[model samples]
Target chain A: MSVNARTMSDDELFYGHKACPGCGGALVVRQALKVLGKDAVAALPAGCMSATGFNFPQLAFANNAMITPFAATASVLSGIEAGLRAQGIKPDGCTVVGFAGDGGTADIGLQALSGAIDRNDDVLYFCYDNEAYMNTGIQRSSETPFGASTTTTPAGPSHPGCVTGKKDLFAMVAAQGIPYAATASIGYPNDLLKKVEKARDIRGTRFIHVMAPCPVGWGFPSSDTIALGKGIVDCGLWYLAEYEDGRFTLNRDPGRFASVADHLRSQSRYRALTDADIVTIEAHRDQVWQRLRQRCSCESS
Target chain B: MLEVIWHARGGQGAFTAARVLGAAASADPDTFALAFPTFGPERRGAPMRAYTKIAARPIGDRSASRRAAIVVYLDDTLFADGWEDELAEGGVVLLNSKVAHPDARVVTVDGSGLAADILGRAIPNTVFLGAIAALCDAVTLENVEEGIRATMPAKLHERNIAVVRAAYDLVAGRARADALPCCSEAAPIEGASGEKEREASSVVSAEPPARIIPQLQELTVAPERFARSTCFQGGHLVSKNAGWRSLRPLVDQQACTGCFNCYLLCPDGTIYKQPGAGSSSTVAIDYDFCKGCGICAKACPAHCIAMVEEGGGRDEALHIRQ
Candidate 1:
């Protein structure tokens, strides 16, 4: 019913941008901006969002944005934050946001993002995880889950999909003892917006890992980009959590977890996932969620 | 060899058009045809050319065709860009043009519009196969239908077949009408028999104007650059992103609720919020930037944005965007 119809205000984005229909990163950015507000600058690396979201002569950003190298989003935003200081503008006054895709964050930009987080750079790094390198036509990335087919990791007679599991990017960020780290999804915009606002107010390297959908790369109808993401969260495949002040917070409680198999069936990429593969993925997700819950309980102890 | 050259933007089904025609020609007992693209920068909306060769005997030319018996233009803008150099003497031109090219032996069909009308989208790939079949004696309409039947899904075959037939009959009917030179509407004015007579007399002069060939610009390429992913490193966006789409998204401000649903899911960031779009900031679609994926239409919560089948200038026969 009317999700986000109340707080709709003047967007910091223009029309006539060239993104494909049902792009999850587009949704994530639009939602994130509602919290980040107008006094924020975006540092985007080459991704699906960077490719179709902005064009030459006229770009899509209504805020001050810079297109950085895929591995250099954090580094570029670091420079921008420092540059803002030279002009006597408080770097903290304006949020320096680094927007990158899963591959860019987990693989290529990992070094830069890690260095920024390690040094506690004044930036809100957002890795809108579409799970693969979607802009270059659905190639496999570190963030892509196991048993999901991609152009590089083709599912065939011997292969079901990707053989390896997805990288634990949130754990990696939280392990650095960063000021703030969290996971969110477009399915829950209220939670997503609140987290973005919290990160906007907090200083140091704040990270928001978003499980955004990819219609073309993920082989789903554009209309299902949002709807399917809800299933992802509902099935406990993607956990909504935050880590700060040495405390773990689970945003969504799985009252009853849906079978991950039931969720994967809708995705064409994971269509080849066998019953056994589904069992393995569900078991693994359960183990991860159990460990995360244990870490969350440490707050009470 | 009956060489056909197709001038279109990238991802506009140029290769598909070539393949369909080639498959249709190959249906014959003794005929063989080959289709391939003359690749440029491989991105959306780049000016691209695809060649099809149909021959009664074995053919060997692998190089791009310098001369053609027929030049079929998939995009209307390429005709304005000048493609006559590829056309050999007595060559016929077939294109999706609103106005028929009378000066040259040409057959014009509103294929884009026909495809949109019949297929619910403006891709016109299979429709041209019928137009080609009607214009060329080599492939029969049955052969083209067979090609369409083979290439498309069972659900789509009937619609595409009908649209292709409509194009074939229209062009074939128009050719016959012009040959007879019957004036549908005649006005007696001074010694002029009718507007038809004026049309016949006003045919381009015997010594037509000389063709203007644009000078070739020198292009330099680095072989090593192809190995890396330049897109992640702020690589150059050389090609026009807009030209790649056959269907374009146009925002209906009156019907929009400023929900930003289209602006959210657009992968290309082609949709932006323009000020004064009504009570709220409604979205704007940049034709030069949109890739015609129709995701915006699917995501429109207000159901106002229409993914109109654009290109080929056949809006009159286009179906309402669903």
Candidate 2:
């Protein structure tokens, strides 16, 4: 059966942690774990998930889980997989996986992740991108998009927040010719679940970059996390795609993009962005999408 | 020395209020104040604490106060077990509750309602600041206003002062710290003083309101019993997180289609899917772990889930069926 809300397992692998209300990252971890199941050995780096999940005397993951150093997520996953296999104790259906945040994957831990993918390690990696270093008080990261205010990238009268574009992580990972790579969002759970299931079935290195909104960092109401996640994809600021066999497939075209301005204005992080700044962001998005449409197969997965 | 312990959720401005109170107390000559907050990895709506200490001499003790002369609860739901034990001899608990608490030592203020009226949102932090100005002789209303101006941004000064003033008047007019009066709605007191002023009034003589016993999901594991510092059972949450919610979602059985959208979308995994009578499956929320993010309600295509005020009532027993 296809992985979806109705067909998902009843057992909860992740629960009762200190993650914020409406935490999109938590949902990604939970849903992905549901797809991966009890045998999946998970490793999380020093991100929101590890900080919230690995409280002393209270472990949140129902399956075997451990925390890695801030920059050792992929390396640790490699080590775990190798150790399990060497000891001849690797479970039949067990899949070694790593869950890291935007900063942990795209910034501090990038080199280690690159090494893991280069070696074609038998592991699945998930980047729950909330677009910033949210756990450490909303610091700017490589994945933080333009015009989004963060502690380091303060928006002021003179300038817009985070002037740089978001790092194209999926493309970077796919550039190495990994077995599989996919882009997902917490707003569309079925798509994310499907990607996870696909990654689980694949043998070589697989990476899934999932956009997870942070209500606190984004300056939106807690209830709007999912809405904002969906809105970002609809507004063309984000896209859903998968890469395999030297081919890139656009899962969602979003033919007529939703209001970019409305989505930007909904989040206070973009409150300082003027109309001109928004125009610049929209222009960039359109240019990127045009290039993507020309290069990638615009067909649903 | 006067010490106050503030009970509030993470984002409720409890630390700000504590700092403002300290600033107010320190404004007085020869007085010193210290304020700090205690929190773990918990986020918004997670229960946490802040403390404020004021003394004539420099405060040497940086530890959390064991007992406080004043204990203020920004969210009344935090008024839980053993609250009375934290009080000093002349201590009082100033709670931001809509319903009147019968205990004379507990002064309930409709702070959330007042804040909603004044600021267009229910931020009850400053309301308690106002209440403290009336209840504590160490700090006056003028001091509080000055503190608000100093501690907060210029744009927020006027509104916070107004809130503080309104709260001060409400508490001062109704009850004093020494001679506490029952403010239950059952007995109506017309005047602030004179004929209405009595040692034991009709409201005081009336039956005390029943203690608010929240129907919380009981826990199977205790934090202490899990001896290992390394790990315990996976998904084993020793404590209930129900305290983190100010609102809760209820599903209307008749309208629910049981698409499992809510169960899938809940960030905390608090929503559960259960097999109903035959083929159809129903959903239920494990209130124990629910942080009340409202994702479930918003995701419901049927529009059956309603997010209601938390203490309005507990979720009805089990399975919101299709």
| Leading candidate by DockQ | 2
Error of 1 at A6 (Å): 2.2
Q: Which residue ranges in model 1 land beyond 4 Å of their true spot?
A: A1-3, A90-92, A297-301, B1-322
Q: Name model 2 segments beyond 4 Å from true.
A: B1-232, B314-322
| Model 2 chain A worst lDDT run, 10 consecutive residues | A54-63
- Label model 1 with its docking quality class: incorrect
Root-mean-square deviation of every model? 24.1, 22.3
Kindly list the interface RMSD, in angstroms, of each predicted candidate in the order they appear: 10.5, 6.9
Where does candidate 1 chain B have its weakest 10-residue lDDT segment?
A: B179-188
Model 2, span B1-322: residue lDDT tens: 6789999999899999999999998897656689999999989999999999876545657889989888999998889989999988767999989899889889999999999888778999999989988877668899999999889999888888889999988999988645322212111222222134233345543763232111222455443334212444455555667889988888776567778889889988888877765677778888888898888888989888888886564344123322
Leading candidate by TM-score: 2
Alpha carbon lDDT of residue B152, candidate 2? 94
**Which candidate tops lDDT?**
2
